[model samples]
Structures are given as C-alpha cells and as structure tokens.
Target: MPATETSAASTPGAQPSNHITEDEASLYDRQIRLWGLDAQNRMRNSTVLVLSLRSLAHETIKNLVLAGIGRLIIMDGEKVTEEDLGGGFLFREEEGAVGTERTAAALPQIKSLNPLVEVTALPTLEPFVGGDETAMITFLKREKVDVVVACDLSYAQMEAIDAAAHAAHTKFYGAGTYGFYGYVFADLGTHHSFTYTPPGKGAVKEVIRYRSMVQAFDRTNWALTHEKTSEGGSPFGGYRRVLKARQYAPEVAVPVLALWEFEKKHGTLPAGREGQAKELAEITSELQTALGVHPKLLSSSADVVSHFVVHATDYFPPTLAIVGGLLAQDVLRSISRNGWPIVNLLVVDSLRGTATSSPWGVAPDPTPP
Candidate 1:
C-alpha cells in the first residue's frame, strides 16, 4: 500500500473530500499551523475507535473532533446519567432523559466546535467485549478506521483489540489510570508482545496478577522488533526493563469497622438513593476482596503514577478534560509519525513528571501475510 494522504504515508486516498468551509478552515487555523497542510488533511481523513470508553472519554472525543479526526466510534456498556454530568464532557441536560439520546445530542456540539469532524457512539459492549467475535469483527474490518484506542479497558477487551489491530495492520494504542498513576502503549501496526516475553513474576512478585491465558504472551515484550514506528514501539528496553515493576498496596481486610470511607467522605448518597448506593458499594467491596489485584501487574519500576482527578470518582469535567487532552495528543503522534518507543505501554511518572513507554508484543518472524 502506497503511503498517501488517504493511505499511511505519501498515499492519499484516491477518493476526494468535500472542501472545508471557511468557518471550519478558520477554526482550525492554529492546528493547521502546527501539523501543516498535509498532516491536517490526514487528520481530517483519519478514523479512530475508542474502547472501554468511559465518561472520561467524552473530552478525548471532543478534542479529537477539534483536531479534525474524520470519524470516530465510541464503545462502552454504560449510559449517561445526571451523575455522569459531573465529568462527562458530552453530557447535556435534556428533558429528564439519560441515554444515547443525550450522547447523540452531544455530537453536534463537537461539529459546532469544529465542523471538519463526524462522530458516532456505540453504547453497547456486546459486540466489542464479552460477546461474539464475528459480531465485532466488522468494526476491525471497516476500511475507514485507521486506529483503535483501548481506554480504561477490561482485560478481555484489550486482548480483542490487540488481535484485531494486528490482523488488520492498523495502529493501536492503550491507556489506563489508577488512583495516581497511568500507562499508555502505542503499537505501530506490529504485534509487539509476540517478540520477547518480559521476565516472569517469581523473583519480583510471587502472587498471581491476572488469571488469564495471555499473561505469558504479554510478559514477552514486543517493543523489541519494531519496524520503524516513527513515534511508537521502542526497540530498546525502557527504564522499566532494568528494574522490577512496582507492586500495588496489599489488601488486608480489617473488618467493616470504619464506615468503609464512603459515608464519612461523601456524606452518604442522597436520601432515597442511600440504600441502593450502599448495596452497590457492598457488591464492589466483595468483588475487590474476592478477585484482588493480579500480583504480576505491580511493579516498582513502572513508568506510570497517579494523577487522580479530585472528583474522578464522581466524574468531574476538568479532570476528564485534562485526560482527554493528553489522550488526543498521543493519538495524533501515533498516527502521524512513527518510532521512539510507541508500544502498548506509556508510563507517565508523576513522581518526576516524566513519560516513557515499552512496546507491544510483536509476532514471531513469519512469512509476510
């Protein structure tokens, strides 16, 4: 495939686009200056899919629109509600309605901000995760979509996107934030994990991290054999390579002696909702206690750290805005350029306020597909 505006490199899509409006062109002047004409055009022509895309993703999507990401698909199992309004950039107050209708209403707002973009929402997780494979294969097969962003994903969803991106030869990126830390990975069309597995978990942390089948495969680092991913898939072992990954705080139940920190902090849910919220809290506590953190994931050497939104638990807009801004910038770099360690893992160290990454797994050497 020739690299053009339409394709990956010099190869522009053979199909022509409708001209941008004066208004649209005017809005993008500053951005156009940064990327220059060709790159801006590429962004106007690119397509992206975001997964496990929580309320936090709304701002990311909004900024992508501003930057002229041509088309977008947002996949999630949850819906918008009054609670979501706290941080959901796409949230709109409607006539007592809370769902896709509100999400749909929000798309025009993006266009209003920047008419160069088009947006779509997928409020269901069925096809994207814990569902039939063929059901969501169409998503990967779509020609217009150039990349997939796995955001705040479930373990199952991440693997699915990883497989789909590899088979399609498309770019893929992933990011996640814990209480105070986060990680991001950029895959430049190469399966990074398939190359060299990371060292195992015995000398580091002995407990099981995640009890899934692909753990061994992931441990193998794919960033080793990148094919010149301009800004992604670093070939060298990063800061994390020389040291042990960090361990998360251990779980030790001291009996429900202290209000579990919910009521004392939030002053309890509103009157009628208290019972339901309490039950929800109970269920979450039980699950956390049961499943626990997968031991393999903790690493002191991890390049990520917490930037928790003060009200991230409540989904505040400003916090999500900052996150969305960061996510979009990374996406732009992954699509427009290559190399410099654009693997699946991006470590943003708050301790020192630095960001670094390791690549995704790469497939073992094989005949060109």
Candidate 2:
C-alpha cells in the first residue's frame, strides 16, 4: 500500500536534536577529523527536504543519512515498478515492494543507514507541482527546512521549486541523471563560506551571490556579447570565447540545453523514438545560433543530441552513483559551510569519467590575498 501524506514531523521516534550525542561524535569521528566537529554539529542539526525517490535520489539519500543529517524529508508520489529495481537499490521485490509508494519502499533502508537522522516520508509532491509557490513556501517555513534537494524533475518544475526555496530563504539543488550523462544545479542565495588562504594566514570569509534557475538559463543572458581583443578586436565576438573558457565541455552542455528546450516545447522528453533525434538536432542548432556559439564548435552536436535523445530517459547505476555522490557532497558542503559549494551547474559525463562545474548566471568572489 502507498504511504499516506504526512507532515515533516510525522515519523515515529524521529525528532530533531539540538546537539550531537557523544556516541554520534564517535560514529562520525572520521568526518569530524576531516571537517572539524563544528561542521558535523551543523549537519547534525540541519533539516533537508529531498523531492523525489528515483535512482539518483536513492544514492543521495544514502549519503546524507549516513553522514548524520539531523532530519530528512523525502517527497515522492510514484510507485515502484520492475524497471526501478535496476538502479533503485532502495526498493526490493522480495518484500513485495513493487506497486508500493516509492518513499515507503525506501524509507526502511534509509532509516537503516543511520538511526540518528530523523527520516520523514511525504508521499505527495502536491505543493511543489503547481505553478503557485505559496503552498510550497509555507511548507518550507512550517517545516523549518534548511535545504531542498529536488532530483529527476523537469527544468520548469525545478525552477518553480527553486523559487519557493529562495522565498523561504532555503538553499536549493536540482539534480538529474540521463543514462551516461547527469547534471546538478545549485542556487544558494547570497551564500557565505570560510576557507584558509595560506598556511599561516588563517581562514578567510567569502560570499557568493547566485542566480535562480530561470535567471541562469535566460536567453537574453546567453545572447549577450563581449568584446574580443584577439580576433581583430571585434566588439561582437559572441559567447563562444566565454563559454569555451568555462569548465564544461561544449558537446555535453549544448545537447543538455537542447534537451531542456525540447522538453519545454513538447511538454515531455523524447522517448528515443523515430524522428525524435532529428527534432532534437534542430533544437540544438537553434539554441547554438541563439547563444551565438560558433557552428564549428558544436559541429559534432548531432551525434550527442541523438545519443541524449535516445538515452535521456534511461538509467545507468554508475552514472547515478557518480552524479548522486557529487550532489550529496555539495549538499553537505552547503549545509555545513565547511567548503565552497558548487557555484551553479555541474555536469558529469560517465562515458569519459569526467565531472566539470560551470558557473551559470553567477560568479565567485575574488580570492583574498
């Protein structure tokens, strides 16, 4: 049976703790040695809301729970199917898990990972699905949610949830895995972090201002041109130089963008059916031209677009593990403020075993001397 809808505090025997117990300290000793006890304590008292229960979410939840987060609220309305068993290790057929609500199926395993972390299951995503964010904002405040991790959602859905999180003054992360490729988008509004500058210089505090998902992907921002002094000093050098200099590879970035555009236009992702690849290719070309990317730079985008269109809905465990690990690491960093968080977007290409981060509508503060 599906789990009933519930509040953040509805879980039995799961209550928020103000301080970490000595046993917890011993359990997290290695983590404490790595990032200090203060950071671990921060994680111990933080509450995170994860919106989804797919393969990606499974890996992320495992990591966060094992790390001793104070509270975790998982929201998902879908039921488990046989296909989910492939990458969703949290679900088991032996227990008659198929056809049951995804969160209910996974809750037991998540609880087993760490008994100290309070786990709440929200069987519905009602508040976040609609266009209005009022309900979502209210829910975040009511639950005192510190962070929101939305996984495997569409571009528009993520944008709406991110807006709600921003309104509630909560950090937000949007992550998804597409077969051999995956991406994570973060919006930590006006975030501050402390880092060491030199061996004896002590720690320096830095602030990073981030743009919402919509602002980051705005077509106008993509169209903006910059002066190029090297290529005949042309004032309209296009975004090629700017984008090429970023950490992301053009082949992966462009196709992903095209996939988003395609979804927005069609109201759904292509199912690797006939002619879908060609349509996606056209969208890729249009996006490249709109973004002023050089044709040669993305000349090989056709193969990538086709590949992504076919495998976009497919799930590969290795890709999920890689992307999910990155997502969890960044979430912990954001919550603890121990290290610098992802400025904006992170792309993982499992085929090449490379993960790169690119700033989208956000810039890092200058390093202190």
What global local distance difference test value does model 2 have?
0.78
Candidate 1 per-residue lDDT over residues 138-203, each given as its tens digit: 667764678777776643456666666655666666665443344454555533222211345221
Segments in model 2 whose C-alpha atoms lie over 4 Å from true places = 1-17, 196-202, 225-246, 364-369
What lDDT tens digits, residue by residue, belong to model 2 across residues 1-369?
Answer: 233333324444444456666678788999999988888989988989999887899889989989988889998888999989998789989998999988889888887787777778878887887647998999899989999999999998998999889878899999998888999998887655555345577666677777788777766655443332211111112443554433346667777888988888888888988889888888888776666566666666677687788788989999999999999999999888877677677878898898877666653322234
Error of 1 at 146 (Å): 0.9
Task: Report the C-alpha displacement of residue 119, candidate 2, in angstroms.
Answer: 0.5
Model 2 clash pairs? none
In order, what lDDT does every prediction score? 0.46, 0.78
TM-score, every prediction? 0.59, 0.88
CA RMSD of each candidate after superposition? 12.3, 4.4
Residue runs of model 1 more than 4 Å from their true location after superposition: 1-25, 94-102, 191-217, 220-319, 338-341, 349-353, 360-369
Q: Give candidate 2's error at residue 39 in angstroms.
A: 0.7
